[model samples]
Target: STGTMSAEELMKRGKRHLSVALKEECVNKNHVNLNIVLDHLLSKNKEIDDAETLEWCKSIIAGDKTYKEFLEIVKSYNNSSICGLVWTAEYVAYRCRTCGLSPCMSLCMDCFKAADHDGHDFNMFKSQAGGACDCGDESVMDAKGFCPKHSKNKDRSKIEPPKDLLFVAEIMIPRLVVRLVQYLRHSGAEKQYISKMTSFISFLQELSETGDLMQQIFSNVFTSQNDYTTYMISKSDVGVEYDIYEASLKFDTINVNKYFPELADDLIHKTLLDEMFFWVIKSKFPEHLVTFLLSILPNEQYKLAFVEVFVEHYRCMMVELTHSEDKSSVSNSVVHISVQLLSPLKLAIEIVTKFHLIHIMFACLKHIINQARYGNTLNLTSNVMKEHCYWPIVTDFINILAHPPIVQYFLNSTSLVNAWADVISSLQGLNMNRREHDLHVEFETETYYKAFSAELEICSTPLWALLKHLNDSSSKQLTINIVNILVTYLNKWFTENSVGEIEMNPDEMSFHYPLHRYLSLLISNALQQQGMELTDLLPSLEFLEILYLHPLHLLVREFFFFFVFPFNFVVGTYKICYV
Candidate 1:
């Protein structure tokens, strides 16, 4: 507290703010006193999730001190963020050096107000097209664009830089457009500075978001064609050997990492990088040459790390493709370069799904099933069996599917069960074709339902406690969806297993399994794919068993348990009551 404010009021406010931060964080949770204040600031409309948090964090990392402070205690500033915003603006305003402008420059290339007439692409300006140069402020400052000593020639055109005057606005302005957005919502800069920076930041974001600015700034930051080429060469995969061979030829290229420290400083690893890699692989950048180039560098070099993040991301993208409405384009050099790029982009997808990547992988299997059901005679059985990359993709998918967000998005979706049905259908198709041999063990959908009893106790623990809410009567729809999903899955599974039901699904209609056993099996396989034991899942195997088979579960939950699955898992290997 400051001025007339007392310490007692500050402590009270601190307690309230702390609770709100934990519960509502940045989003409005409608907690009366908290909600009202946040609503006035338009906080209720903001998304409450990891993405928003990350974006907020990035703003700070991008050099907005105000944002970084917001991540801490909002009340830390004497009841206002105004001071913090001004501090942030001053810090970013110093970026003129990178923009290749004089210290007094205020005009921005992003805003096109600071455009230099000389042909210097981000280089030192021939004529000082400094701040307000377009408006011709140079003449006002003596028409020479500089003092007599700096004015070498009278004919030389010049722009006037922003005056280094003592003003709050100068210090509060954010240099980048992204930082501006944060300033608007979170920055407490004075009204004048807010309006000015708001307009400037918005203007720049629209123009700088794409075209030359983005291409120039983000070329090496994220995945690019060259990165993808490097990634694929590292994988040593087939069909795209040219990049490796070609890279072997050009081993003498200078290391940009040395000349440009900025390159090394801004180096990042994220899933989005795959976008650039994907582009490169499609275009087919030289892999062999790329690999040879990389060989000269150390293993930990960004040159190599980029490739790892790319490849891991490639696996993720393929799995996500199942959820997409359309198919991706064919591969080429750009695609080739991208395909074998980094391990995986750690951006938003770095976290593992709570549902298990295996479950999602199984869902993809359903996609293949759906594909097979359509009656295309591509001889998929043998072809799929021979695919090496496909298996790892499936395995990785299963692993990630178990990740918290991944699982939440997956299990919550009705499409998940359909995906599983498609997987079964495809399996049935393969078994019928049996051009080679038996593919997988036949577990009827009912067997899966039995195993689902394992999820009952998951609510009792913290690991997956959030899912415990699904057991509440309030979650009737969730219960029904889960029940119907698992039930339908079991039916399809049994059809594929118990009998010679080798034909494909009837139509484009969504899939539904009807057996408790199959649901259990699906869950079992999912956990296995995640390399986890049943006990590792929250709600404990014992609890899920009771919840799945007990009458209480059906009464409280909207979805009725199909049957009683004893502590004994039908799979026998996994003890439902234990691990």
Candidate 2:
């Protein structure tokens, strides 16, 4: 009796049973217990030789060998034996039968007296050794003794779902997979169940690879067994009574789209694009189709297909946007269209290998920004960005730039930096009327500051990465550009509120202090390495004088250089002179 014990507990108990069976020399008397022991042992210990154990167990059960001899015959097992043990069915030594409407059915002893299957005739036969009804006798009758329908009839609804999917004819194999994957997530299935379903779907997909059946199924899902039609209409005269119901009918027209106006012809296109982005979400297993597109080196044919699909979609949206005269619709659609266009590009930023790919992506972003700004430029009260909708894209792009891999790539690739910098410079110079300009001027400045601030926060600071590579004088211009960006960010942060004196929380120093600390370290290291005076590291002699004037700056500067500035002498000399 295994009872309700978990697998581990059963294994432990089975090990004890093996010890007893071996020690008592009772293998011939208790073949069932011996079988259970052997199965559990092989299941628990993979090293036990399964072939030897199976042969030995068979021999012992047949009374050809004693327990002591069988112990000596078996040696080890492999992981595969665990599976063999589970699938092997055991014979029931006793039989019980129930008088039911269908026929007499055999059950194991447990079901013979199970109170749930009441008001039925039962007969017990001892030591018969036959297979029991694996479904359990309860399936034939519920608690009230009513005949329960066979599962085929009960589960037909599930096994054969209604073939009522919209655009069912037009859906491709990849599109079907996308919807199913989405369904799997939306269904909230257990991880184990989802894994098994995905594995089965993968198998089906593999089978689809063999030839035309798959292509036909995908390309012509609307076709019935005999014809290519997808929808049917009544053919009997409207007033005539005829027995047309018995005749097999073929589909003639599709009007499901006409009923769903909110999602019209564009709905088909939107569904495809949305499903195409399964890889962007967390739960999706991207390797099969979605992930192939994400790879830095995808198959050239598939890559071209993906690019063409994206470009065509963009062209369609742009054409629609240009024809629309509604101001609010134009403004809202700009953000909406940009979101769709940029999402895949945003995902590619971290993984893209080629600098040329980055250039192309940035070019797309530049065009989107320019088009949005240009559309609303004439209307003084209108603005291009809706903060909630548009800023998320901007924030995501900032996060991508701040990613360590992307930042490291940017530092190493001069073209990547220059390309991105060109886009940033263009954003800064958007020409507009003063009234419209003032409305979003602050927001535009904040965006630039946000970009720089985000870039600096890579693994806590870009300053750390910059300092490590600063020794290479060839990247001096790149380093200067980054420093200038950071300085601009700091200046914007400091001058906010336009107060005469801006007070910063002493405890909040961790957020902003690292910038100054790393910069001071960078300057000190540059001066020491060049074997030149401070004047050489500073942009000009005037900047050197400001550093020389500030005692605190000198102290911080000397500290990173492993020394202390002597500030006590200046105060003491002043005191003596006054006396």
Candidates in order, TM-scores: namely 0.27, 0.30
The candidate maximizing TM-score is 2
Give a tens-digit lDDT track for model 1, residues 479-533: 3455455555444444434322242221111112123433454345435443444
Q: Where does model 2 exceed 4 Å of error?
A: 1-196, 204-274, 279-298, 301-462, 467-470, 492-512, 521-579
lDDT of model 2, residue 170: 23
Error of 2 at 499 (Å): 11
